[model samples]
Structures are given as structure tokens and as C-alpha cells.
Target: MPTIRPSGPADAAVLADIWRASVRATHDFLSEAHFTEIEALVADQYLPQAPLWVIEVDGSPAGFMGLSGAHVDALFIDPRRRAQGLGRSMIAHAARLEGKLTVDVNEQNPQAVGFYERMGFRQTGRSPQDDAGRPYPLLHMRQE
Candidate 1:
């Protein structure tokens, strides 16, 4: 099993790479301008404030999860490492920290929604726009 550890300053660059690769792979609904804009914010602003934890696969960073209180702020895996259970491991680690977990999934990402459902999260609500007022719809979910 993979171990989850608190992120250090050194993990920032790789985490940003994972974020970019994962987002580009799954967030095709994002416009070029929107993607670029959010990328900068995540790399410079949001990531710095997030309580991040990294999962190493084969002695290197493979993915990470960001937490805010009991809510999942963000979770991303290297695009090449998807379907390898890295995401599941990250979520399990998050659950261990707080038995109850909440996350907002982009509605257009059915794969992510289904994965979370398989992991026992259920939809609690919906929003027409993301937290940042982006046009992407969001589906709120909770694991309890």
C-alpha cells in the first residue's frame, strides 16, 4: 500500500505537474483561457494555501490530495498513473484523517463522479457554477 505524507515545499513543482496533466486529461470542457487562468492560480495561490499530502509510487510522487478542514480541496494523479489505485489510496488516507469527507466534483467528469460513488460518496447537492464562478457545473458529494 502507498503511504501518504504531508507535502513539503519541495513537492510543489511535481504537484503542479500532476495537476496540469490530470486537468488536461480530464477537464476537456475547460476553455483554453479558463484552463490557463486557473492553472496559474492553482500553482501560485491555491496550492500554497492547501494542506497537501503526497502519495509516492516507486519512490517518486505519483499523486496528491489537498484538504481544507473536512472537505477535499483537490485531488489529482499523474495522467500516466490513472487507474492504478493511486487516487483510491489518496482518498482512503483522507478518510482516515476525517471519517467524513466532502468534495465537489465537476459535473462533466462522469469518470470522477463514478469513481467517488464507487468509493461510497453520494451526491448531496449541485451548483450551476464552480466555487470560483466558472461556468463548469459542480456536484457536491459527501462520504459519511
Candidate 2:
């Protein structure tokens, strides 16, 4: 099992890299411009602003999860290190902190949606655009 720890602003650069790598692997529907824009935001804004936790495997950072109250704002694992239960570990850690987690998943990313569903989340609602008002649709989900 992986251990989770609190992350600070100093971890943003590396976490942003993980976010880019993970998104590149899973979010194949994103355009070049959109990817660039979102990447910048992840590094400059999101990672710094959100309360984050880092997941370490074998004493190295492998992934991160960002939380806002009971909601999951973001979760990303390094592409090379994915599918090894880092994501599941992060979610379980979050569950300990906040019961009944809620998350917004990108509808175009079937991998994420399916993963969330397999984690016992159900779609509670849908939005035509993302929280940032991007064209990508979002599925609001809550763990049950």
C-alpha cells in the first residue's frame, strides 16, 4: 500500500508534471491549445491553490490529489506509474478525511468515469461545460 502525506506549494512543479503526463495519457480528446492552457493553470494556479496530498510509492512521489472540502478537485498519477493503485489509494485516503466524496469527472475521459464508477461513484448530474466553462462536458458524481 502507498502512504499519503500533505503537500505544500513547493510540490506544485512536480505535481504539475504528473498532471500533464496523466492527462496526456487519459485525456486524448483535449486539443493542443486546451492542453497548453490547462497545463499552465495547473502549475500556476490550481496546484498552489488547492489543498493537496501526495502519494508516495517506494519513497518517491507518484501522484497527487487535490481536495476542496468534501469535493475532489483533481487527481493525477504519473503516466509511467499509473494502474498500480495510487489513485485508489488516494481516494481511500480522502474518504478517511471526508466521508462520501464527490467529484466532477470529464465526460470525454471514459477511463476516469469508469474508474470513478468502479469506486462506487454514481452520476448525480451533468454540465454542458466544465467548471471553467470549457466546452468539455462534466459528470458530477458522488461516492455512494
Residue 96 displacement in candidate 1 (angstroms):
1.0
Off by over 4 Å in 2: none
Model 2, global lDDT? 0.90
lDDT of 2 by residue, 64-85 (tens): 9989888998889998987898
lDDT of 1 by residue, 14-100 (tens): 889999999999998999999999999999987766779999987789999988878988889999999999899988888888888
Residue 86 deviation, candidate 2, in Å?
1.0
Runs in model 1 with CA error above 4 Å?
none
Task: State the C-alpha lDDT per candidate.
Answer: 0.89, 0.90
**How many pairs collide in each candidate, listed in order?**
0, 0
TM-scores, one per candidate: 0.95, 0.95
Q: Root-mean-square deviation of each candidate, in angstroms?
A: 1.1, 1.1
Candidate 2, residue 141: lDDT: 99
* lDDT (Cα) of model 1: 0.89
